[model samples]
Target: MAGEEFEYEYLYKALAKYANEHQYPLAQQAYEGAGAAEKIHAAILKEAANVKTYEGTTVYVCPICGYVMAGDSIPERCPVCGGPERQYEKF
Candidate 1:
């Protein structure tokens, strides 16, 4: 999962650069936001790698930015793009 997150992080960062060069501000923002989250995810996944047990862990995804959150609960809004709680998908 950490590897995947890192990979996606690279992709998102590249896309953000491309979008910015192409003058697509919205796309650039989305990509940058997601990229930031992916980096965070990589670290989080690394920390969780040694854990063998699982519990009532909830997952939330910000639809607008592709930001992911995994834990007992998610924040009221996405820290990167500020996506509201109602806009996040739960799993």
Candidate 2:
């Protein structure tokens, strides 16, 4: 999971750089979405390792975008896509 997180981070940075250099707004937005998801994944891994547990938890992922939230409930709106909470699917 940590390795995956680093991969995502690398992808996010590379995409962001390319987007900026090419003035691709869509790609820039995708970088933001990817970054958000990667941060959440990294945090989840760190927390699980610290507590030595991974039970009775939920991870919500926005279908419209890659926004990820770990908790019992989803956010009111996806920070990246502005998708409604109901749009999030459990992962």
Candidate 3:
């Protein structure tokens, strides 16, 4: 799963770079947003390797950049994208 996440992160970053070179602002932002999620996913997987079991937890995902948080409530803004807490989705 970590390998897959890293692969996706690389793909998104490459797409973002290409979009930027082509002057496609929206496409670039979209790819970058996806990349943020993939980046977080890889990190989470790496750290989760120490865990032996999973339990109930509320997970939040930032809509703008796909940032993630595991808690009872979300932060005022996404640390990665600065998206508002209201914009985050429960997962």
Candidate 4:
């Protein structure tokens, strides 16, 4: 059972790599064998569950360059891409 789980983990990594490399068919195959989109969704949800949500501090990421910002108000400019406050996403 442990070995099977390890194999699935390996498949997950391979699938992610294939996806990054734009081999969608290979990635889809691996992802399906590893339990498909639900598995990925569950993993994301599980990781998100562990995060400590802050009510006071607003966490934002810049859309242009994925620059992260934490504050009550948007920054004047994104540190990574020089994007304006409107380009930031709040979480």
Candidate 5:
């Protein structure tokens, strides 16, 4: 889970870079958390800043079920539904 979050940070940085390169104010603005979008915006901002802390990192969600995968990588099997790693999705 930790590694995945780290990876997502990389994704975020890439997104931010793209947003900056294209001068997409909405994307840039989307990086800033506000109201209902606060959590997502914060994640994007963390990526932009190259944040390394998962203290506030959001957990991965399993598309197969409502299970939340926190910590690092997806488990070998879902404790809730016995789904494989492929069942998990980034938040």
Candidate 6:
């Protein structure tokens, strides 16, 4: 999982860099979203390593955006994309 995260991080960073250099704002935003998603995934892995358990926890992923949140309940809106709670998919 860590290796996958790093791969995605590297890929998104490269995409973002290339898109920005070529003045593709939309592509850059999409790459940024992908990068943000990987970052959240990495953070969750780090947290899991520290806690050593996923019991009594919930992970929510936004469908419209790559936003992710771990908690007891889904957030009212995605922090990254402002999607509603109903748009989130639980994992």
Q: By TM-score, who's the top model here?
A: 6
Comparing 1 with 5 on TM-score, the higher-scoring candidate is 1
**C-alpha lDDT of residue 14 in model 3:** 90
Question: Could you say which candidate leads in lDDT?
Answer: 6
lDDT per residue for candidate 2 within 1-91, as digits (tens), equals 7675875778788888899899998888888777777777777777777886657778788888766688785669988779998788886
Candidate 2: residue 70 Cα off by (Å): 2.3
lDDT per residue (tens digit) for residues 1-91 in model 1: 8575866657888898999999999999878877787787776677678777556777788888777788866789889988798998887
List candidate 2 stretches off by more than 4 Å: none
Displacement of the residue 45 alpha carbon in candidate 2, Å? 1.4
Question: What residue runs in model 5 are displaced by over 4 Å at the alpha carbon?
Answer: 1-58
Candidate 4's displacement at residue 18, Å, is 24
The TM-score of predicted model 3 comes to 0.69
At residue 39, what lDDT does model 6 achieve? 82
The window of 10 residues in a row where model 2 has the poorest summed lDDT is 2-11
Model 6 vs truth, CA RMSD: 2.4
| TM-score of model 5 vs. true structure | 0.35
Q: Provide C-alpha RMSD values for all models, in order.
A: 2.9, 2.4, 2.9, 9.6, 12.4, 2.4
Candidate 2, position 86, lDDT = 79
Q: List model 4 lDDT by residue over 12-82, tens digit each.
A: 66766678678687556445444433343354445556878655766776665445556686669864446
Candidate 1 lDDT (Cα, 0 to 1): 0.80
Clash totals for all candidate models: 0, 0, 0, 0, 5, 0
Ranking by lDDT: 6, 1, 2, 3, 4, 5
Better of 1 and 3 by lDDT: 1
